[model samples]
Target: MAAEALKSDFGGKAHIALNDPKLRANFRRAMDGLMTKRAAQFADADEWNALRARGAAVRARALAQLPELLERLEARCQANGIQVHWAETTAEANAIVLGILQAAGAKRVIKGKSMVTEEMHLNAHLEAHGIAAVESDLGEYIIQLAGEAPSHIVMPCIHKNKVEIAELFADKIEGQAYTENVDELTAAARKALRGRFADADAGISGVNFAVAETGTLVLIENEGNGRLSTTLPPLHIAVTGIEKVLEKLEDVPPLLSLLPRSATGQPITTYVNMITSPRKAGEKDGPKAVHLVLLDNGRSRVYGDSELSDTLRCIRCAACMNHCPVYTRVGGHTYTFTYPGPIGKILTPQLEGLDCAGDQPHASTLCRACADVCPVQIPIPDLLVRLRTEAVHPSATAGVKGGGSAQSLSESLGWRGYTAMYGSPLIYRVVTRLMGLFGNWVPASAPMLKQWTSVRTKPKFAAKSLHQLAREKGFSHD
Candidate 1:
């Protein structure tokens, strides 16, 4: 499944998603509700702006000294008795995790919601090695059961409505009957997973904020599943991108203030678990050993660019996805990557090469709605434009992976021709006059118009040029 994702067929998948009425309806309803709720949370314009600014500043400060902070984080965590591991790539990270689980003689593992693990394809890797890993988050569990990827960052199974889920449960879950009652479905899921939490050999979770000053791994969730996933088992392993580290504990408040409100429009999540170290000498419930795996996975390449480094400031609040018009219509699956929407458009191509995901940069409408709502004030639209340019005429020094892979001889020639006509006044006048004289004679079946006319009308040209009209009106002199 992950191998197939490397091939770029975004246009084909987007076409299918656009035609699926069920998918479109699901996304429309979900996105609308999320947008409404988030707006209500930020009803006060003054407060919202102030909070967003602070959040952006906090993230920027951490990223500016990311290397120093990471070293500090490792030192502090080791001092606190939490072992830290580093991986340069997903393959290495998977190997490190598999070795840890094997060393502990673990066979069954329960996991909390973590996009980093998804990026690594960690579940598939573990299963291949004869270890069973179960997603404990309700939304994550539903998708896992159905053999699907998450349709949204915050809501994994948002693409599945209650009736669909009820049918799935009835078919998949033992001793379960088909029912649309939300509470009944919830109870059934609880009954199924309740035993796994207690019996699992190990727990794995993602860190929302890894504080360097105190070496704390913070996770926030409404369900107690994250708490259980980290605490119940004797061995706990936390994984996150290196970009998730923060400079200090004080930097957490502004981000915490923005994450939930921007994600699901809540004042705060039900649970915010902070793990300073493994179980202390006197503690009874926490894990006996805790390991932190900070995975670089192309993050350093992204960090090298002064402009693209802003991408690291993302808190994964996913506010950009919630407000994206393109995402609302096509849904997450169209991107064919772990992340979907405005963030994915800029992020995927950078992590994966442009050769693999170059088409993703062209998927946006450049609406700037994502930038406006971003908690960290990332210039999403500007980044999209930069990526688009990189795909064709990339910077020689930038060294973006697979840069210029999307360039084409015909496209380059066409642009050169356009430049030539516009650069010379005599050629421009001749071209415009000729276009006005015979443009309407061109057929919709014309080769140049085929793709454009497939979904739109062929434009009709006036017999008189705008230049001629301006001259007649005494508005111009030649």
Candidate 2:
């Protein structure tokens, strides 16, 4: 959502990110502590693997029948008097939402924590049209007040500690004391958002799982904010990526079990909401009008590829970011995309296309840690490798001339020179002496060498060749 700083230049952004001590420490502590909790949740490797296998099977089957499932879901929702809308892109999704709000004459909206909305960049879109949408989730509200995109999908404000959040609250909300106490801080946030919730003209939320067989929308969260955002306002709007659909209500148990355990190491979240319809005739409370927006936004592209379709298996548990070595060091801001971390590596490229998300796939070390921790068993490392190939060697690109990528002409030329010199013994001898004589004099000013010396000192090549010295000492090739 935040314009990837100097877009598609991962190396440049990573270089700057790698130097942030605070970012590094916060990510390390949070990721490490949460990973420990996750590990504790599954002490039995056998049981854990079994659940993952089950989760993967359920997702594969659901995805295999996605088209049928989606249709069934639409029918079920419509039958319950919930209007369903389909959006092929972010702009289309935003337009659909705005149209609904305008039709209802809604001025103020309160939103539950929905990454799909973030994907659409809906807050800014709404603000541009003079519609005020406020985030109701505690973490989301904090980041929204700070005027920042979520760093972590599951924990939107995971990057901000209690003290930092206290500072933020004291600065933003009027008449609030600067208290670092967690309860006090949460209470302050609750008090601040409570007024907005009651005044909201409409409520918008995201679906964790959509049941096609029964036509239901499922939301899981720790706080009651999700409840307020989806039920309090007269108009309720729900949005989710199309991949969230499941064929049967029975399949939800295994996934529901896996999501919180893998995400926050809890067996079950505090609130598991199932919305079958708007408030019925006898219901005293609930939105009178309800709408569901199914967003494609390149997800169908990912789903269409059999090899990449496994990516859709993600429940947005965000386990990939939790255990990621690259993500932990650089933090989410470095990725400069909505998703960030390993999942972002594969998903961003497909959704945004290779041109806009060109540098994202290479942001990983391909360590396969993400695949190992994934509840649905998405082959993240393999997918990352696949995306990397597509990014660097796009079918239309040859020799990397002018694609607006980090691969420079000088880097390519340097590689060519290295290949030539290393292949020939005579050329190697000539180069080694020239290197020994003047390698240090090559200077940090050299175009190719500057990248290597950006953070560390230049290396000094040895004055004498080991082969020559060995020959003088009468040693053979052995």
Candidate 3:
């Protein structure tokens, strides 16, 4: 498909995704495998519930004191010799990173997998400024080479199969032969990225958790790339949302216990990197200068609402996506945002404004599958309904960004008529009788029924009212 053919809206993109057999098969296979793995990891129901409760409590505590914890984190990080920068928006975040790189005269950077960077569009910003940012995470590297956004948060290239990847590697990687062998393909990528890690002027990454008490930036990955990106270069810069802050280092274990098991069904990842500060004078093999960029990017708005604050409890586990029927079918690209699936449906609208992403809330089937699988137990279905209500009837305090932007006069009037008919007994009876007289006469092509009838049969209305039948059958209303 041409770039111009791609649609920004959810419906258009979903239509394209649903029709593509290859894409559907790729996502179905990936989702099923992930679901099975995650289910196996949490086989004991009692253990799963207890751990979920503990993790939720830990996140709730952190978010409750978010402001104080963030301030304390900055102080502790500064005391530990880690420079901290704060940005209210993605643009500011980009500029802060650029200034840090420019100050160090860094023209090349190797990156660890960070969804926040994707949200910031950091690579494009840096490239436009004449700096090169190379993604070191294998999945990230693959999609970056293909000039595509991540289709899944935990697995960026989940939309493509090995054969497509073989083609991509063959075409994009110089002198690389087409091979569907997973190990060989991985080796090829490692060979290509080894030089970038050693020669890059700086490294950039995303923090999984930032402990306020000890001032540590924690990142977990199955691959060693995250470690190399943060340690191999002389300069390292980490960017993350402010919501990632935790009140204490002790709170890490409960969340960590659930994160990997929920994400990829692993007991533990291969590498867990924790950076307390920059390299000391005698210290070797670490960045000499370390910087942390804390980005708000509308997270504060999400945090402001007590009901919506649950959204921040997410630990970036893709378990919700893996279990979501809608997401599994349409894939992440259909969401057309940095985050996708149930979490994205709620998070994207608040971050980007409902005027841009109002349709996302309505995309769900409200199956509650996402909520059931969420590691933190976020009530995704409830939040979707909340956003839907905010669209037509905005809060008086201007709570949600672009609230009420989806409202339409015709829809509002139709709803009003429905309310009136349902509220009045006489009106209901008269409308039902009239409908029984002429409802079936309404054609499938009628303006209101056309879209509804596309996949479903037109509902036939009875010629006689139920009340009339009851009277004829000698049944009293009592």
Candidate 4:
């Protein structure tokens, strides 16, 4: 695992993702099934909307008092025998985790599916330092062996069909043969990872929700890996973004009820683990030392911006991405970040900077389908537009938005020309007349103009402009 993770080079990723036919088919099948399941679970529309609104309110309130809540959580975790560490950036988070592992004298680590680790490029870092970090989640294991990142948040290998997975297992796993059976594939991965679980010196996991009232980390998953990762090892380290915190234990239920259902359309996932602390005095199982790393990584800055703070409310349910036309076409990897789809567009610029992530906000069609399905009721489309504005006009942000290297003299000039023509009726009429008269004569060598003519011939423009014809026909009240 080289540190050169899929490169945050956004300019060419969408083009590559769009052209991959096999990936497109895989997404189409996966998305259709997920949408069907989601629809079935929410047969009563009113109940769904009510729950969604509650989730939004709870998240907004928690974020409003985040600083106080985090301090409270740290104090409470210490009271429960759990050590908590704060990391302001990905590098700081990685360094803290590595230092903890080294202090425990751990060389082999087993992991549950955690996107924060992916964001930090933790596996590559650990590999470079001679630590073997093994991914135990089936889909995570599949992609790890393939040397590829997870294409979807909920379904990591959603871009790969059973056939592709079968092929990957046959090629990567020793003595394994090719088979497209789903159960067999899962069984193969389970067998391969079970040994790592028993032998791992330490375990790593991700937190879905952190309840500040009781100082507990909540995890939701279908498979049993998350449970094993926390309890089986001598030491456990949980990593997550600071935004995952909740104010009280009671606050977790409303968000939890919606989280699994929103994410995978199940009434409840098979496994939900709540870790309040490490093994106490005489506990037979659970880690001897439990640590929680709360990562800021530009999140505190995002929280400071009133317009973008709503982005922090996301529970990683990913309902927005499921309904997004752009995400459906290009898949997650096209965004070239750990969090992809609608969430990625707003969050990536903050974490990776606009210089690397500038193209994501522009990829949207502004269809607003994502906003409609978001369980937390985050106004994703509005945030997207604000990000675009920040990119094109950085000074407007007042440093509230992330980095932006989007200033372009030529594009700005083109917008000025559009305004000049469209803002005045006489200029608009003249411009239309000139284009209608000589647009075809402008040679095909003019590439930008050729784009317009390619779909529309010069003769398509009528002798009379649309305005003149409308006036003649008495359709214009003006």
| All candidates: TM-score | 0.96, 0.88, 0.96, 0.92
User: What would the per-residue lDDT of candidate 3 be over residues 1-478, giving only the tens digit for each residue?
Assistant: 1221223499889999999999999999999999898999999999999999999999999999999999999999999999999999888999999999999999999999999999989999999999999999999999999999999999999999999899999999999999999999999999999999999999999999999999999999988999998999999999999999999899998889899999999988898889999999888779999999999999998888899889999999989899999999999999988899999999998988888889999998999999998989899999999999999899876489989997888778878999999999899999999999999899999875687898799999998988889989999989
Per-residue alpha-carbon lDDT of model 4 for 242-279, expressed as tens digits?
99999988888888888888788899999989999899
For model 1, residues 39-65, the per-residue Cα lDDT tens digits are 999999999999999999999999999
TM-score-better candidate, 3 vs 4: 3
Q: In model 2, state the lDDT of residue 440.
A: 76
Candidate 2 lDDT tens digits, 77-139: 999989999999888999999999999999999999999999999989999999999998988
Best candidate, TM-score-wise?
A: 3
Model 3 weakest 10-residue run by lDDT? 1-10
Instruction: Name the weakest run of 10 consecutive residues (lDDT summed) in model 2.
Output: 395-404
| RMSD of each predicted structure | 1.9, 3.4, 2.2, 2.8
* Deviation in Å, model 2, residue 408 alpha carbon: 5.4
Query: Candidate 4: misplaced stretches above 4 Å?
Result: 1-11, 395-404, 422-430, 443-464, 467-478
User: Which ten-residue region of model 1 has the weakest summed lDDT?
Assistant: 1-10
The number of the candidate with the highest lDDT is 3
Better of 2 and 3 by lDDT: 3
Task: Count backbone overlaps in model 4.
Answer: 0
lDDT of candidate 3 vs native?
0.93
Error of 1 at 355 (Å): 1.5
Candidate 1 lDDT (Cα, whole model)? 0.92
Instruction: For each candidate in the order shown, give its overall lDDT on alpha carbons.
Output: 0.92, 0.87, 0.93, 0.87
